[model samples]
Target: MDHQQLLSLLRQMTLDEKVAQLLQLATPFFKGADDAGMITGPMASLGVTEREVRNAGSVLGLSGAQQVIDIQTNHLKHNRLGIPLLVMSDIVHGFKTIFPIPLAIGCSWDMALAERSAEIAAREAAVSGVHVTYAPMVDLVRDPRWGRVMESTGEDPYLNNLFARAFVRGFQGQDLAGDTDRVAACVKHFAAYGAAEAGRDYNTVDLSERLLREFYLPAYKAALDEGCEMVMTSFNTIDGIPASGNAWLMRKLLREEWGFDGILISDWGAVKELIPHGVAEDEAEAAYKAIRAGVDIEMMTPCYVHHLAELVRSGRVDERLVDEAVLRILQLKSKLGLFERPLRGADPEREREIVFCEAHRSSARELAVKSCVLLQNDNEVLPLAGTGKIALIGPFAQSGDILGAWSWQGAKEDAVTLRDGLAAAGLDASRLIVAEGCGVDAPATEAQLAAAIEAAGEADAVVLALGEHAWMSGEASCRADIRLPEAQLALIAALKPLGKPTVAVLFNGRPLDLHGVADQVDAVLEAWFPGSAGGAAVADLLLGKASPSGRLAMSFPHAVGQVPVYYNAYNTGRPNVPTAPDHYVSKYLDIPNEPRYPFGYGLGYTTFAYEAPRLSAAELRADGELTVSVRVTNAGRRTGEETVQLYVRDVAGDVVRPVKELKDYRKLVLAPGESAEVSFTITEPQLRYYHADLTFASDPGEFIVYVGPNSRDTAEARFRLTSTV
Candidate 1:
């Protein structure tokens, strides 16, 4: 259908029908009642009748080919205009053949792998009848206490923006209208959901407009620029208003300024939440506010279904607003060719063939290996000898709960345990001594601790697989104390006395406070919830079958008090000097200001040495580009991949600037004894920042460019920007 046809369909919709199009219902609403033909489940409390349910434009959190086909088929039977129901679900990481969580994927610093993961997710979801994936959550996260940080890429705006684009491209592909394997991408938590106060879920976010535009908003904008089909409003309040009802943010900024004509859907129950946010009096007012603010669909809520029609009839909301939203919905349906084929890409045969297939699992295993970060390898304890008896201890040693949260379709039983991975990698079963040291968060019994110690004593070396349980992170699972449980710490203490070389393999969702664990273990591998193939990947890295190339996408804080520690923090008036006295400075009395591990910090089997940065010119014109180059050599015997990062700091600015901001980075594969000159072209736009007045332009000033392996340690050079054209 073309624009004219979509408009014609919208003109024919009644007030109730049009309002229903803006409401998304769950699957139970359409499923016929058991025995008797009465409608059942949670649909009654929604205040929606049978006709309203049939008229609902979309279904949330429902998949499976036959299920979707039956739902759409039943809805079309009762509908007057024969509009197909859109099926949407949370395909954040993967559908069935799960990959590592988004945070783990971010650590890879491999955009191509990120894109491939999204593509695999899309293919699997599309076959199962899912039309849109609420994914590529681009919120910039600094506080690990926020459970949803597992969904975001990381703290750096530049890195988040890159991954955002990659996810969108991979999900929607080049042409969403024609691609059968691709599912529409919904870039979500629209504004600044990641900046929740105290890192609590659904908390208020109070940020200066300058900071908002400079940091939080870039990734969302990048996703939109990449042609994501939908945007989900965050549950948090931006400034003083909830994002679902913020007209300035949704209409003026997203629609007018960003020119995002795509569909805007409210997060789950966010429409009714407007009343609690103090922005709306009741459901009626909430519907009016969200509709006026340009929300197209209200997910898992009755606000739009219960009050939108009444508001329209009372003249509180213009019927044209309803028409405009319905048109966007119809347009998407047309783009998806839903009217032509109600089942779209839903095929039972395809679903069976693609879900958890070997090829997809292979990709997952490879990417999982790339996502594991080698945080510490003191005395070269890693690359464990395969011939020796190895002790695999800790709760995750044989646990299959390696799949992180938000992977609703992934089953824990299908996961590869570390012991299984070791065996698959050709390690002799008799040589692998496994013990459940303790439960993920539960206390270990004396017998359990004794058994773990004995196993460690018998083995040549110990591989401690420790981390938070799968339920510890994701939505509504925030942790005030982001540290390993006391039980795990006790297990480590018990094993530390064994006098054996121990490797700490962390399987967590967020950056943890490893102050104690780091000292006890000879090697530390930060594996942020590797998915189905996590075990295989861990085994590969352990036996030197693969190199650890992943980096820290988020900074690992030294302690819980440093909740918001990041590399690109602002320089205060009294900055702490490392070599000078700590009096009257921005310093912590108990600990240093630096993080346990800085952003982009990771180690592989090999080592890299960086030469001092060099600039092609001392100064650059506004229209010209300056070339900055650095020579990096693999200083160790083995080959490895290195992420050479380029960061810039403005000497002076109209607004206070971060101490350093990542601008560009290149991940290079280097052979031992070989060196390569990595060059980055710096243009005037790279130096531009949002000023106090909200003007996004660069001011002529001196800038320092740093080239390094990680943010904390770098080689620097000076340059100048002449003017802004």
Candidate 2:
């Protein structure tokens, strides 16, 4: 309890206990109050009595460890200054060994397996007592009609700032106040809320503060430069205010230009949603504009427990802003020692021997086999054969709902499904044949399409298992037709006239519109919502015992009017050049401007190639650095894992840039006919950006650099930066 004992417990709390420590509320308002304690359900019209439910301080969502040790042992038996509460939840992507959804852990460009799935979801939410984990939602999404783009980690801002510093160093582990198996990582919808407008979830986001500091504030400033101890605030509205009231985005750019002295809070109920975002004229002017726009808590709102102690006793708010938000919530409950262990990592026998054990389901089956992406295989119809006869048809073939949609303690009866991963891979239960064939978007009747076309005309391989319905993709689940579900496309047009072979898999959560199930599948994959050992990592990547090294961290659009299609866009002024095929360029007269799967596409059951980008220098300067290289190889006969990527582009940019951008990548692995090389140093702060007077820098010209395996088949070269420090 330092900082002079948290400023002597914030000079003994009371302006209604420091406005009930900025108010949070939930866990059924301290489990359905009323023995004159009053606070009933839905926070009883927000007039919450019983002294703001015995000084709220924090609770939201709530978790287990003896239900947060019986709500901090009944709020320390209503004692006036004990202060323990805290709790928090929505442990995005697994609190019970589920993994694979942060856009399939950003298609496994594995940042150390996304920091070991955020350190095994901060050790199963710190033994189920959860001390904050709104989670690594580093919103940079290029709109997949924003149903929380499966809790973002895609459309690259340098790959969502490297999975937002690998989920804030795997949920604040390097000592988030001395980690008891860590948890305090709240980096969320703060700034751009994934540019909502029309991609729509909470709506309005206008952008251009140089595209919100070059692409949605670099994964929330790389999860507050990886120290992440909470941030939240974002129900949308940015350039016209609302990110929980905005004050130049939370007090002049997050506490005086990004110094972010942690704990901000507010997203659910977004402080009485500033009166439906017409910018408040109620709940005491949205609790005086979210505590003068710095919002330290206020989650399920009561507009800061009904107008923060009458706006701090009518001085128009400022009891030193409620003693600096109760001294950053008692300096985060004295850096979570919580006045010395108020059930810190609450045990319950370590939450039943660590939630889903087996070394967290073997790191959720090795991050669901590097988050399965394969995309399409064609004449080489995937590895399948474990003595075929297969045909596991639709409705997630023996569904366990594959844990998507903010898992919330995952456990569709301890998930595993595709017929329990092909009977744990030995396969033969009379050669498999499964078949729910209908419902992931309803309609399959004609006797479930003649028993899925007579079990794909008596199987010799079918696999199918379709998509969407873990409530069709996270938060408010968007999708204005993100395709694939006309009764799983009529059970894939009644098993594509049973010619056999098939494969598909899918199970989505955004980035779909797979041009009608990629022309009736010969292979496909794209397993986005694979969690809880997603059907034993899709039967070990369909019997080859694993390989499809994921990839496509967002960009599948073949159509949904290409709603914000991305692979680093911006190249117009009449550009669609096929040596100038014209009707005034930027083409799209009915399809084909690219992307049906691009941004670092994916494929791996062996095939690499590459070799054409070289350049150890053609000029760099401003504290020089250059490098480049390429090589690649595997070229087929098995062993895989590629990634490569790189990107760049500048050539003439006092402002119009992104015709390419990613910047750096690597991944590799290889083997058959082996090869390697790879390189990429480049420096000058990877050609800095944010210009148009926002001044991030880097100009003196000519860049190019490509080197690919994905952003639309690359291979270029050419250098030059030569100035701008």
Candidate 3:
């Protein structure tokens, strides 16, 4: 049926039917379970039967081959409208075969893997009866102290944009209208939710228009360009206006400027929280505000269900708005092929067997290996090749704390611990000396430190893995200081004097102040709390079977006081100038106003040399394009991968811009003495910015493009864009 025909059908429906299309329940209702297996009081109250919810709008947190089949079958055979229920869930990282967190995946700088991860996640999720995933969170966060940093791909807009499009492509595939498991992808947190005040989760986002467009909004636009089907509103307030009810953001920017045609869902309970935000007087008012502002669906918030109809009747909202929301929701279902073959996703054996199959597990392991970043390796102490008696010193060396945040389904029982991987890798458990140098959060015991020191003296090399527990940097787990908690640093200091080569494996969700560790340790490997096969991946990198191609997502600060340390921050009026006095300048008396480890900074076992950037054309018109190229050669003995980063800067603009912005990047694997030419095409959109009136357009001006290995170190070339319009 044509979309207009569907809209006509929706108009013919009765008021109760139209309102029923807006209802969303928490979980799926199964028929026999009410009186047979799992009897409960709530099941009896709402006439909660499998038949009832299957007839409703959609269900959340329910999927599996058999389960989805049963629900959709009911929709086809029993529901009044014969509308297939749209099943959705949080496939943040992986569905059943869990990969590393988004932060770890971001380190790969390999958009291919990110895309593949999303593809596999969609495959598993689709087989399980899921029609949508609330993912591809493209929030740009600068502060590592923010707990949800693990969920975002990175702080850089370019990297986030690339990953966002890749995720959309992977999840929805070539065609969402034809594929059963290829569900619609939701580009999240419609506006800036990452710049939370004081690095607190869901705090107010206070930023100027220049800051918002230049840094935060590009990635969401990128996802929309890729044909995402939904947009999730953020939990934070933008400039004193909660995002759940910001018309200028949702209606004006997202809908009008970006031309996004999708369902807008509020973050869990954000609609009702408008009362707390002082924007709405009550739940009824919040429903009115959010609906009027263009939010179509309320996730886990009863405000839409309880008050939307009342608002429509009271003239607070137009009835056409309700029909528009319902139409968007139904159109997404049609695109999911729910209308054509409503029971197609109901294969029981395929769903059960596909969840954690061998292929997904292998991909997870490969991603875990690729996501591991070697921050520093001195004297080539890594790739511990020879079969020697290695001393693994730390509680983490044998623990099951590798699962990063949002690991809702990953349990320790299902994970491969470090000890298990070491054993499987043929390392003698008896020969591998172990010592709990210190607790993850407590001071190091003197006796434990002595045992580790004594073991280091007798070992060929010491593998000292230190970092936070799995619960340290996720949602609601924010910290004032992101450092190696406890006395792990003290323990490392104690074992350093033993005159043995030490390889430190640091595991954490966010970046930490590791200046002291970098200064002391001979080698450092940043293996974020990887998922189920994390141990095996770390072991593979340690043995040199897989090269570490990962890079940093967030900047490592020198100390906690230097919060929000990132590469793209604006240059001060007297940047890098000798401060006349600390009081009058943006300088810290005790610390330098720079990052400990800059964004895009990562060291590989091998080295690469770069030739000066080559531009195809010296000038570009506002309506035209240009190609920027560079030759990268693997100058070291080992064959490895290097990420070529591209940064752009507007010399002068109507509005002030950052000193630099990451525009594009590519990861290349090269053999020693081999060189590869990587090029990126720049269009007018790359030069566009939000003016005072919030229109996005490029200004004819001089611009500089830098190509290099990371954000801090780069080679540059200048160009000019002529005004053609």
Candidate 4:
């Protein structure tokens, strides 16, 4: 429908009907649901009625062909205006055919693959009757203690922005209005949710406007720039006001300044949370502030449904506010072409055929291969020969915890175990000995340890599959001590005495402190929760069918004390130089300031040597560009992939700047003796940053350019920028 038609429909809606249109409920509230469910418990608690459920504009956390079809058919029968219900789910990583976690995907540094993952996820979800996915979580993160870090790309604003754009593109394809295979993308945790204090979930976030705009806001803006259709408000506050009720953030900045004209939904129950946030005195006030601040949909709560209509009837709230919110909801359904095809893309047979098909699994396997980072491979101990008598021992040897969090629809029973992967690759049973050394978090039994030792004693080498269970890391799963459990570490220590080549393959969701494990194992592979074909990808990489190319997106600290450790940080006034004696400097007494493995750090089967960067020009004008080129040669015997990272430092700026900031990067594949020249064109606009007063521009001065394998180790060159005017 056009604007006038939508407006006409909105004008015809009664106040209660218009108010109900802004409320989102789950499947259990309605008739014809999968099960015979009722709306008593939650609705009675919040004073919402069955009539409101019938008039709800959307559904949350419910999908499946017949269920969606039944719900929609049942809903339209009672809805006065016959408005269709939008079906939305947290399809964060994948729907059924699970892929690597978002953090692992960021490690791949392959934006095309990341985009393809989202595309496949959309394909699977669309057939399952999902209309929108709350994904492309673009919040920039430096603290891994926040469990949602697994959902974000990483800490670097530039890299996270790139991945955010890719995810939005993949989720909402070019023709979202006409494509049944695509779903509307929703950028989440709007503003700075990742900067939760003390690495706690939903904790308070405090930052200056300059710092927030500089670091946290870029990725969200990038997703919006890529035309993402929806936005979800974060649970935390901006300037002491909850985002769901902050008019300055949602109205002034996002709606007016950024020009985002899409639906803005609250996080689960976040609209009602304003009461507990101490901003609103009661549920009625929560609803009043949320709508006035521009939250179009209230998910899983009755604050909006119970109070909105009354507020509008009274002199306190405006009826046009309710009308505007309902109009956006209508426009979203229209944009999705729901009026024409209410059951858009919902096909039970198609869902069964394509959910976990071989082609989709193959793409998942390839991506998992690129996502496994070889954190340590001392003396070239990896790429195990298939001929050796290998012992696969640990909790994850035959465990099915490979599918990480947010993979609710994924079939854990279908996961390929490590033993299954080895056998499927034609490794004879006689050559592979397997044992369950210990549980992920539970203490190991004496018999289990004895069995593992006996198996390792007879094998030529040992591969210990270790990690956190899928439940340990995700939303509300933050840990104060981000390390493997003691039982798993004991298994590592027990295996170290066998005098055999040992490899520890970790399947986790966040960066862990590997103090005991890395030192004890000959090799450490950070195979983050590698999705469905995780075991197969591990087998391929271990046997040299594929090489490890993944790098760290988030830093792994030496200890949890360094919670916010990252590569791009300011050089403090009293810098802690490694060579200089530690005195009156910003150095820890118990540990170092540097991360155990810095951002962009990874090890492959091969090595690369970098030459000094060559600059095309010594000075760059505001209107011109500066080209930087460098030569990289594979110094090792094996063929592998390397990500050449580009970083820049402002010698002097209007304000303090990070010592090194990631600007651009290129991934390369080289033969044993081959060399390649990679170049990047740096423009003046790329150097612009927000100043103290919030003015965005560049300060003309000397800049140092560095290009190499990772952030820590790089070769440097110099260039200067001069304003054209």
Candidate 5:
């Protein structure tokens, strides 16, 4: 059906039916036809009637084609108009063949690989009967204390925007109207949920409109402009109003100004949360406020079902709101070709053939390899030679917690262990010794410690695999202290006495403080929850079968006190100088202002040399573009990949500006001692930033251009922008 046909369908729906289109329930609610207890179990707790269930527009957290077929068939039998249900899931990283977390993937600095990961995820999900995925969470994050930072690309809006567009293109494809393998993409936690105060989850957000427009809003806008089909409202309040019911954020800014006509949904239970947020009086008021704010769908909430119809009929809520929302949902279904084929893309045979296939796993392995950042490799202890006994210690040495969180369909049992990868890489098993040094966060007994000491003493070198448990870093899992658990630190401290050329392979979700590990270990390999193929990826990097190419998207702090440290931070009025710790500056007496490892910082077997940048013109016209060029050379004997980053700093602005902001980047694959000259074309639009009044424009002033492998240690040149207008 087309737009007019959808409008006609809306005209035929009863007020209750129209209201029900805004409601989404879980998979259990749809099993009532076969399981009689669903009515008394999930339905009772949900406070939804059987009539609402039949009329409900969508379902969440449901997988498998056969189950979707059964539920859709049963629903059509009960509904008057036979409208199909839109099935959505949290298929963030992968469906069955999981990839690295978004933060880890961002470290790869390869947008093409990022898109391929999303494409594989969407293909597996579409065949398994998922219609939409809440993915490409484009919130600009700086606080590592926020657990969901693992879901974001990084702290910079420019980088996050690139990822946002890529994920959307990968999920939706070029023509979602024709492709059954692609699912609709939903950019989530709309607006700045990432800037929660103290890095707490679902905490209130209060920022100037300037900062919101400049930093937090660009990635979301980029996703929507890239043809994302939906937007999920954040749980936090902005400008003292909950985002689910903030008209200025939803209707005025997202809809009226930005021209987004796609579906706007609430995060789970966020619509009814307006009451606790102290914005709504009751469920009826919540329904009125959400619809008024232009929210089209309410996930896991009955407020829309119980109160929307009554509110609309009583003239308290406009009926057009319901009609517009239902039409958008219908348009999505029609775009998916669901009206013609209600069981669209649901094929059990395809699901069996595609999910967890070798082709998908190969892609996952490739991404995981590129995503592992070699943080430290002093004395070149890695690429272990078959010379002597090697001891592999710690909890994750053989653990299968490689598939990180939000791998809804990924099998932990199938994940390749670090031991498995090392063996597969042709390591002599006779010379390899393995032991559980300690639990991830639990102290080992005296006997366990003694056994670990014996294993290390017998070995020539040691590899300690350590990290936070897989459960430590998804939604609502925020930690006030972002460091390794005491038990793991104790294990590190215990092993420090051996003085072996130790390599610590970390498997974590967020960038950690690395207090005991980084300082103690000879080499630190940040193998962030490497998903199904994580072990193989780590093995390849360690054994020099593949070079480590991943960079840091988010910064690793020197201490937990530097929770929100990032590369593109503002130059404070009283900037801290490393030479003057006692000066009256913005300095911490105990810790430095800089991060332990700055953004874009990573390592490989080979070293890189960056020449000073050269500008095309000393003075750039406001309407013209400026080209900055630099030659990067592989200075080591090993072949490697280098990500040449371009950054700019406005010397002065109307308001405060960041010390440096990422403008463009290039990733080059070079043979040993090869050289490549990379160039970036900087446009006036690229130089623009939001002022205090929230006007997006560029200033005619001096700008410094820096080119390097990472955010820090860059070679710089100067240029000036002149306005012709």
Candidate 6:
């Protein structure tokens, strides 16, 4: 049915029925029916009791396509209006076949993979009857200490924009309502949550308009351009106002300025927290403010369910607002074809047939191997060949804890443990010594210290896999200390004197303080939670069949105190002087303020050499575009891929730019002695900035462009922009 017809029918219904449209009830599972006593009742609340479920819409969680089929089948057969519920889940990565987290995948620097990952998520999600996903959290983060940085695609606007469009294409596909296995992607956190003060979750964000436009807004805009159907508000506050209630952001900017017509959903409990943000006086007031501000869906927050109707009945909120929200909700359902053959998409037998199928496992393995960023290698101890005895020491050495946070309902038994991978590598189980050197969080014991040293003694090379536990970093799992916990360092130090070549394989979600490990380990392989087949993937890289090409999405700080360290930071009045160590400069007293590992920092078994960046055209007119080119050659014996990053800095502008800003990047694969010319088209958008008047403008100025393997290693050239704007 058309939205007008659906709205007309909804309008004729009672107020209780209309109110029910706002409530999103939780379901148990598809295999069991609600009346079969499988469902306990409405999902347990953080605080509120189970409200009545009579006219409520439902959101599916942990339930597969079959459950969605059963739920929608029951809704059509029994409900008064036969309004099918919208099924949504947290499809952050690949749905059934888990891929790398957004941060790890971002290192691929491949827009195709970002889009492909999303498409796979959409395909799997649709197969299971999901219509929407709260994913592609386009919050540009600079803080490595903030645990959620693993969920974002790193800190640069240019890179994030490329990722944002790819994510949208993967999730929504060409047609949302028409596709059986595609779900609408929700571009999120409306404004600057990444700038949360002190690098703390839910902390207040205070930024200048110049900073906001320059660093943050581009990704969200990119998602909008890609036809994203929904947007989720952030939990944090911007300029002392809660994002869930910020009309200036949602109404004026999102809906009015950008012309976004999608449904707006609030983050969990964000609407009710307006009182703490000092915006609303009560829950009823919160309802009125958020509804007027253009939030169409209340995710996990009952404030909208219990109070919205009352606010609308009174003069506080316009009734048209309620109708508008309902209309959008119904339209999304219609697009999902939930109203029409709702049961056609779900097959119970097919559900059992395809979850974690071999195809998915293979894809997961490829993603895991590609996601491993080789941070540092000395004397080339890696590419472990020649069939020597290896000591795989550490808790993660045998761990199958590949499920990064917010994972779906899969058991540990289904996971491919690291032990499984080692066996597949044709290594003798008896010869490969194994020892739990220390726990993820506990201090090193004398026994663990002794065992690690003993294992190191008998091995040709020690592969020490060390990193944070599966739960150390993610949403609500934030940490004040980002260093390796437990006795990992002590254990590593003890094993260091064995005089054997040592390789460190880290299974972490976020970047860690690796200064100590860098000094001790001969080689470092950063295998961020590689999903189900992660173990096999790491083994493949270790055996040299696949070269590690992943780069650091976020910078690795030398110490926990340097929480928000990143590459595109501003140039201060006092910079590091080569000879003059200090007076009147932005220098740290104890240690150098440089990051332990810069963003885009990674290593390859082979090496590539890049000629200095050269501009195709010297002068750029306001309307004309020019291509900046660089030639890169693989200088080693083997084939390798290099992420050639392009950074631009405006020497003088209407408003100062970051000392360095990532404008463009290209990942190129070359064989030994093979060379390729890489180029990025420079346009006004890439050169524009938020002016002093709070408007985006392009100014003619001296510009510096750098192109190289990573942020720290680059060659620079200066050019003058003679744009006649």
Report RMSD for candidate 1.
1.4
TM-score of each: 0.98, 0.37, 0.91, 0.99, 0.98, 0.95
Answer with 5 or 6, whichever has the higher TM-score: 5
Candidate 6 error regions (>4 Å): 28-52, 60-62, 444-446, 579-581
How many clashes in each candidate?
Answer: 0, 1, 1, 0, 0, 4
Q: List the residue pairs that clash in candidate 1.
A: none
In terms of TM-score, how similar is model 3 to the real structure? 0.91
Worst 10 residues of 3 by lDDT: 30-39
**For model 3, what is the C-alpha lDDT against the true structure?**
0.81
Error of 2 at 614 (Å): 9.7
Encode model 6's per-residue lDDT on 1-725: one tens digit a residue.
78677778777866656656666545652224444354444344423333335456656463576566666766666568777777778888877778877888887777876787788777777777777888888899888777788788898788888899999998888876567767888888888877887778888898876677768888999999999888989888776778898888889989998998878888877888887888999888888888888888776667777788777777788888887777778777777777776653566676666667787678777777778899888999879975878898987887767768756754456667666787787777766888888887677688887888888888899998788877877786677777777478877878887789999988888888886688998999988877778888888888787899998888888887776888888777788885877767987777768888898899998999888888977777778887789999999989988889888888887755687888878888899999999998888777887889887777886888888888888998877678646
Top-lDDT candidate index: 1
The deviation in Å at residue 658 for candidate 6 is: 0.9
Candidate 1 on 183-237: residue-level lDDT in tens? 9989999889999999999999999888999999999999989988899999998
- Residue pairs with colliding backbones in model 2 are 417-420
lDDT of 1: 0.91
In candidate 3, stretches whose alpha carbon ends up further than 4 angstroms from where it belongs are: 1-5, 28-56, 70-79, 442-451, 578-585, 614-629, 677-685, 692-695, 699-701, 720-724
Error (Å) of candidate 4 at residue 102 is 0.4
